[model samples]
Target: MAASAEKLLNLLLRHGSLSRADLAKAMHLSRPAVSGLVDGLIRQGVLRETGCGASNGGKPPIMLEPVAERFGTIGVDIGHETLLRGVLCDASGKQLAVMELPHGNTFESISEQALKLAASLKAAASIPVAGFGVAVAGQVDHAANEIVYCANFPLKNRGLAERLAAGSGLTVRLDNRARAAAQWEYYFGAADNAEDFIFISAERGIGTAIYLDGKLFSGRAGVAGEIRSLLLPSPDGIGLLPVEQAMSEKFLLELSGNCPDTAGLVTAWRRGEPGAVRTVDYLIGGTVYVTGLLTNLLDPALIVLGGRFRDLGPEFARELATRLKVDPPRQLEFRLSKSGRIGAALGAALGVILENCKSNEP
Candidate 1:
């Protein structure tokens, strides 16, 4: 897989299908060069001719697309909650299988469950499994394939990737759930054209991932977006509190009269229940403050609200837009995540495909 060929694959993944002329134009390569690369990819079963494109007064050019049955990758999202989610994706980012299982009660138990989920997805994949990617909620040493620390789980310094690789006999990559989601969104979802944005993962706790220029910004400690400790005015008009406590899933649930889950809270909000209204108003205020703070600091172009935030519905974004007061040089827009709850899992799978593509490049 030469770098040019890799770019060809990426271009196809981005555009769905393209002709040799389109590839050549996008890659800035001659048609002969693009044809040679496409020929190689077709022979390798990585790509295939789909159909003929409409002609501009000449013979219709053949369109090419990734062969969904040629390559596969497994991704597992180990969230802070009790459920572990897994997704099997083909080279083109098309999901083959999706699964969920209960997480273990302890660190070792959770690791084992995650491995189990991976194996199950691998069995379900019709194509060759490239590797496994794990998106966890915490600080991860990506190069080391280890979790440095996680507030909800006792997995600090744990060689999670090593254990998974050993158990499944596959390569493994680890990353923060927020960063994983951000990367996937940038390449495939709402932020496809965005070069600078803030991805806010409002899961069990608020986790943020910052993308600057065109790359994720992991600070010196590889936890630059860890804003849980940032102080904000309490919803009760009392003294300040950690952002994590002020705007956490737990707090939201509590505010919604201890609703069983976010879905129920959304239901209550839709019904215009008093408790849910208070909960939403508090969440809006906190979000406005946080977005303004981040805008003043980094001045990103977009803000993506992911995880449980997606359950907040489209109205949430509308309300947020009205309340947010940021005066950056450029206007900042807020959008809900398009990937929903399975975003981290899908992103983790995309990571495996990307890493395997790089490592196996010829």
Candidate 2:
């Protein structure tokens, strides 16, 4: 069931639709076997048949879509700044329930708070959470299953996965939220159509998720997108600065005097406020400079924008694209992800879903 379903869905996602014959050839299964699985899924209401295709002088083949409300995965995005947003995503990438964790950023405090959120959401999940993926803003050690460091978070020691897993009785894992978002785009967003691209996430922190040769480029060390490169010098000339130093939630707030970093920017940008425009420009500089520095290295074909600032909308994306055009990559496309906040959690869920979908040895 897992292998056939994965092959079928991957085919659907890739080609938009496929007949049972196409699926059988793609999955190396017999037509009868594929039909049985498709029938089962259709009856379960998780796969819907629609449309018609060429029929070689016979009845046209019916197309199908993975139901948007089948199985759900719990995704946790923990901010270094004491905010946590959890979302339940069904098999088709639709968001179900969102559990926001609003608590102080202490390790113990957030852990306890997260446990409660997980417990409540777990009970709420109509079908068990297919898996749990917890993404964080700071350094995370996937192999060790711990958070090495998250300066913005009030938590002293990291690693919240263990506590959440123990409390909820579910398998859990950690990933850098931005990279997770990039993975989501590569799988389901604007980048889905591009062979290579970079996912730049800007909000409180600046992060990158580069995709090359049609795969999310998570480096050997798992820190490919963390551009801490004090490499980006601020025009003010106050001190050597990292790309994030000149552009983050903290920097934006300092620019405006007060307000939640992302939400406030959304409101300000909507009103055409001067301060918002300036800060937005500052953030664009970091993105522009980073692209300039890395273009020679990765030579991405596109760049997709996501994260909290995604709420700022297409205008922000256009502004960045206008500047980026000044020193464009050798060749690259630009897009803003609709996945936005949902990407991180969806990628986390994909981690678990795809894991269970591996084929048995032939």
Candidate lDDT values, in order: 0.84, 0.71
- The C-alpha RMSD of each candidate to the native structure, in angstroms, is 2.2, 4.0
Clashing pairs in 1: 1-362
Q: TM-score of model 1 relative to the true fold?
A: 0.91
Best by TM-score: 1
Stretches > 4 Å off in candidate 1: 56-59, 219-221, 328-330, 360-362
Per-residue lDDT, model 1, residue 96, is 83
Q: Which stretches of candidate 2 lie over 4 Å from their true place?
A: 1-9, 13-17, 21-59, 64-70, 154-159, 256-274, 325-331, 359-362
Per-prediction backbone clash count? 1, 2
lDDT of 1: 0.84
**Model 2, 284: alpha-carbon shift in Å?**
2.2
The candidate 1 region of ten consecutive residues with least summed lDDT is 353-362
